[model samples]
Target: MVEKEGFAALVLRLRAEGISDLDLLTAVEQTPRSLFVPPQFAEQAYSSRSIPIECGAFIEGADLAVRLLANLHVKPGQRVLEIGTGSGFIAAVLGRISERVMSIDRYKMLIGAAQRRLDSLALRNVVLRQADGSNGLTGEGTFDRILATAAFPSMPRFLAEQLVSGGVLLAPLMTGEETCTMVRLTKTGSRFDREDLFEVPYLPLVPKVASFL
Candidate 1:
């Protein structure tokens, strides 16, 4: 199994690669990726590559999340929403940067397992639920930030409507040749500006009411 110090070394590399946020770097360092993956691959936890976990899920690449969060102007007391909880690694990372975070996944089992991991880590600010992440969170008129780990063919209109007037939404928008094009949508009055940050490959967003994408 990878040692905690080994993961720290990886985070340090990520930092040198242009991720300068200390809070984010620390979150990625402190959150144990090994705990969320299957026991067999626990040794590869912090290797910077995706590994399969239970329920046919794959842990998200830390670099992808690092690229997304790098553009987010998230504050410590901000309320954030994370879609596609996956192995809950990103959610754990988000927990360190926000006061309250709600992460949704289409798989119930993933949520259950993630909850146990979060509980074990004593991460109390994140709430996990089984729901369609593409549709965005309901009843929340505004959010300080919205992050999606899943790739969407097009930016969901619901997500656009949910962001606060000046908030930002980070997700992978599918573009040609690339599996996903990392884009940031910044809400401005009634319009949003899309900024392409990088390219990535992620599991497709699960449709409403159906899990297992």
Candidate 2:
């Protein structure tokens, strides 16, 4: 299992790899990955890999998650919405940066488990819910930033309505016949400016709250 020394090494490695946002890295460092990883995967908590959690969902590769968050550029005091709240690790880290984070998952069991993880960490700003998480968060009001862990066959243009004008949405979207890539959509006056960030491994967004755990 990775210990304190491994975490320090990870920060140093992230720096060495040109992830220049020290504040973001600090937040990542402060948020222990082990707390969110399932017991069987505890030893992989600090590795640069995706850790499986409850409900057959996964936390993306640690470095990949950081890259996406870096592109999202979540600022302090901003309201963030996270779709597919897998292990709740990203939301917890975002909670440290943003004023509040509303994370939703299709799997009810994932939400309950993730909420417990957030509570244990004393991260009260993050709220987890079992919802479709496709486009209906408007009830909670628009967010400054939105990020999705699941992939969509196309850019979820409908989400623009759920974003504050000028808000940014980060997601993994299908680019070709069978490939998925991470992209950022910036709201721009009734339109969106799309930026394809990089390729990422992600599952399709599944609608409906799972009835069974």
Candidate 3:
């Protein structure tokens, strides 16, 4: 297992890598990645890499989580929505920066496991649910910011509609050739402005109904 000092050093390395957002760095420090992973993988939790959680799901790399959080531009008291709650690490980080966070995953096992971790951390502002993330949570109404950890072939219109005007949505869009690229969409009035952020590798965004039990 990594000691506290080692975890702090990892955060410092992330800072040197251009993640200048102080809030994100602080969140990373506050939420030790080791606590969110399985006991066997605790040693590699603080490493700058992704870890498989369960049912083919993964806990995203700490650096990538910071990049997504930075791009979302989340503010205190803002309501944010996260599509994948693997290990609930990113959702907890979002909770640290925002007033409320609703994170949904298709797998019940993952949601249950993540909920325990979040509860142990006393993150009351984050709500975890087991549902089809691709459909988004329209019943929860519009969100100030939305982030999808999984990659999709195309933007889900339902998710776009759930964004409040002037809201920002970040997700990885996959090309026909199976390459993934990060995309940022800002909802403006009835239309949206899209910007391609960068290329990244992410798991496919699968719906609950589409998943094999």
What TM-score fits each model? 0.91, 0.92, 0.92
Candidate 3 lDDT by residue in tens digits, 127-163: 9988888788868989999999789888877788888
What do the candidate models score in CA lDDT, each in turn? 0.81, 0.83, 0.84
Q: How many residue pairs clash in each candidate?
A: 0, 0, 0
Given candidate 1, what's the lDDT at residue 173? 82
Full-model lDDT, candidate 2 = 0.83
Instruction: Report the Cα RMSD per candidate.
Output: 2.1, 1.8, 1.9
lDDT at 211, model 2:
45
Worst 10 residues of 1 by lDDT: 204-213
Q: Residue-wise lDDT of candidate 2 within 1-213, one digit each (tens)?
A: 375766776666677777779789888888888888878877777778877766777888777778788899999989999988888889999999999999888887788888888888899999888788766476798999999888888778777678988899998897776689988999977888988888888887777645444
Q: Better model by TM-score, 1 or 3? A: 3
Clashing pairs in 3: none
Error (Å) of candidate 1 at residue 92 is 1.2
Q: Which portions of model 1 show Cα errors greater than 4 Å?
A: 211-213
Instruction: Provide the lDDT at 61 for model 2.
Output: 70
**TM-score-sorted candidate list, best first:** 2, 3, 1
